[model samples]
Target: MADALTRDGIKYMIARLLENANEAVEESKENKDDAYCAGRKVAYYEMLDILKTELDIRDQDLKEFGLDIDLENKIA
Candidate 1:
């Protein structure tokens, strides 16, 4: 089996995935199928959540990136 990815590796991949999704959203703005694009974006976000869980990423991890999200409090 392949070795597991490091936390940094996962972070890098997450960023890349988000960037690709954002670009798709921008391009999709010109398309007529908004619902399909929105659905795809939701799927991408769910994948990000999976990666976050795989790394056991929490509020503190996000704080390191300047994202002051209160995961426990449902605030940001």
Candidate 2:
């Protein structure tokens, strides 16, 4: 997809994904198959949004989480 996302766009998309995940969790409890899949996908996408935003922020502003960043390259 040539339409690669920008930071602002990713922010909006993440907000929407979080919203959808909230809805999906509720819906999944009452159905089978795709409902759970939809819920998990929403959660995954929302986390992606969070990581992207976090990375874009200046290091001075990032709150310390005590995470071992030296060991991994987290995917967005």
Candidate 3:
């Protein structure tokens, strides 16, 4: 098993999980019949919730951790 994660590690995971969840959503849109896509979305979201709770993270904390994603390229 891996060692306990540092705060940065958790934040990094949070960012990656968010990205994966976003991808799952897009994939689900393309293939609504894919059960695996729905499962991935649920798993990623649950993991994110657990990690965020462990770190007591808020939306602002995500931004502070540089995890504020602009998946839609909305940020200029």
Cα RMSD of all models vs. native, in order, equals: 5.5, 8.4, 5.5
Give the clashing pairs for model 1: none
Pairs clashing within candidate 3: none
Compared with the true structure, what per-residue lDDT tens digits does model 3 show for residues 5-69? 78778667666777777787777678878888767766766666565454444544656554444
Q: What lDDT does each candidate get? A: 0.55, 0.50, 0.62
What tens-digit string does per-residue lDDT give for candidate 2 at 11-72? 57655655665555556555647755655755655564456456646452222332223212
Counting clashing residue pairs in each candidate, in order, gives 0, 0, 0
TM-score of 1: 0.55
Model 1: weakest 10-residue lDDT segment is: 67-76
Query: Candidate 1's residue-wise lDDT over 32-76, tens digit each?
Result: 478777666666656655655644555346533322332222210
lDDT of model 1, residue 7: 61
lDDT of 3 at 23: 81
Give me candidate 2's TM-score against the actual structure: 0.39
- TM, every model: 0.55, 0.39, 0.62
